[model samples]
Target: MKVDWSPLKHELGEWRAAGLTLPLWWRDDDAVAPTESLARLESLSATSGVPVHMAVIPRDATRSLADDLSDQFIPVVHGWAHVNNQTEGKKAEFGMGRDAHAARLDLQQSMARMRDLFGARLAPMFVPPWNRFDAALLPTLAEFGIDALSTYLPRQTATPIAGVTQINTHIDPIFWRGTRGLVPPDDLVAQTVALLQARRTGMQDNAEPLGYLTHHLVHDADIWEFSQQFMQEMCDGPVRLYRHDTKGFS
Candidate 1:
């Protein structure tokens, strides 16, 4: 499906005319091992000049995967095992059904493993699998030395849990509930336009960087193409590439 990016393009043009810059970031979740998918993701990042915050599942992630990552990649922790314990509800690795203490321990272990593997390249951010987590776990993040938390939707508050700052992805190209392929291009573009409009009009926090989320392992060709095109177009406009060390709370 051909995407009509006119709405987003017009909004970006307005920002450009006003000399406004949108801090733009990309995140790709559920990475464990090195594969051709990861290589393709790196190639896309190199071409578009957008670095990906690669969310690595610590329990299954190997140090070998770290070798495939370039300086353009920032490794962030993505839950311990990426396992969903919720028996009857929506999937979540850190949901209320599980003991919070045990979950915290998992997080601590993951942090240590990630630090050992990625070292200074680790962003110290926690991205829960499936973007689902129990709110009771938020206060415990700072105690575990986690500096940032990433999830879905625009962040409701920048510092939602005092020391732990929140950054979230606003645009996701996948239609997980349906085709598991790319969402209709027109719908994605329109949603992106609406998100930007809300920020521009003070309906959303403009200070929050606009985030694009992907799963490199699951992307179809259409998803890959859209990602490259969308990111490149934004780069050509008034978007400023966001880096992990400089932009977020971490």
Candidate 2:
């Protein structure tokens, strides 16, 4: 299958040599339609030398694509079933600012379950559903064998958890509306450019890895092209793409 990599591997290697890395973490392996989108992203990302992180859930009510990309990027657990049992106004409450103890227990089991199934290939990173989480869950998450937690919010707690890690993205390309499918194209592009600029002007810190979230099924032709171009331009000298492992990153 063919893939669409924005800034190819050759350039990525160059960026690595220069000490700047753009860690691109893609979420949503549990979407209703996972086959075509996930496959296309994996094919494209692998070809371009971009490390795509796949978040898998045991029972997504659909096929599991984790085992399919053994030759491609790394795999992590997005969440079990990617389901949100949070309250009506707070659907994506995996990590907000409440329920420390319960969240810990919930994640503990998820971690063990994922390890039993995925083995060492599973990195200890957790991306909550809806790309939204509560801030109060991080420190507690650390105790549940979570090495890193990835979220879509730009602001996170400053408290440190010795060995645990944290990664997040400010720009989300996927479109969503009140738990709906995907959003429109123009809105996605606008968000993309805004985040790209945020990274360029140092609005986003160097310590925190940059993020871009995608849902391949929402492939509106115009938005895809714009996304491709926006990322390409953002990847020039001032912009670099790199990935950092939980333990490896300082």
Q: Which candidate is the best by TM-score?
A: 1
Q: Give candidate 2 regions above 4 Å deviation.
A: 1-34, 61-64, 93-102, 157-160, 178-203, 236-239, 244-250
Q: Pairing residues by index, what is the TM-score of model 1?
A: 0.95
Model 1 per-residue lDDT tens digits across residues 1-250: 3667788889998887777778889999999899999999999999987889999999999778987788878999999999987877889999877887788888789988999888888897899999987878887788878988999999878997878888888899999999999999888988988888787777999777789999999999999999988987788777777767755422
For residues 1-250, could you state the per-residue lDDT of candidate 2 as single tens digits?
A: 1233333444444555766655444443444334766676666565544566666664442324444555455667666666676666667747455366666666777777677656777777777877776656666667766777776666454234666566776666544544344345445545654554454456765556667666566655544554555455445434445444444431
C-alpha lDDT of residue 68 in model 1: 72
lDDT against the true structure, per candidate, is 0.87, 0.57
Leading candidate by lDDT: 1
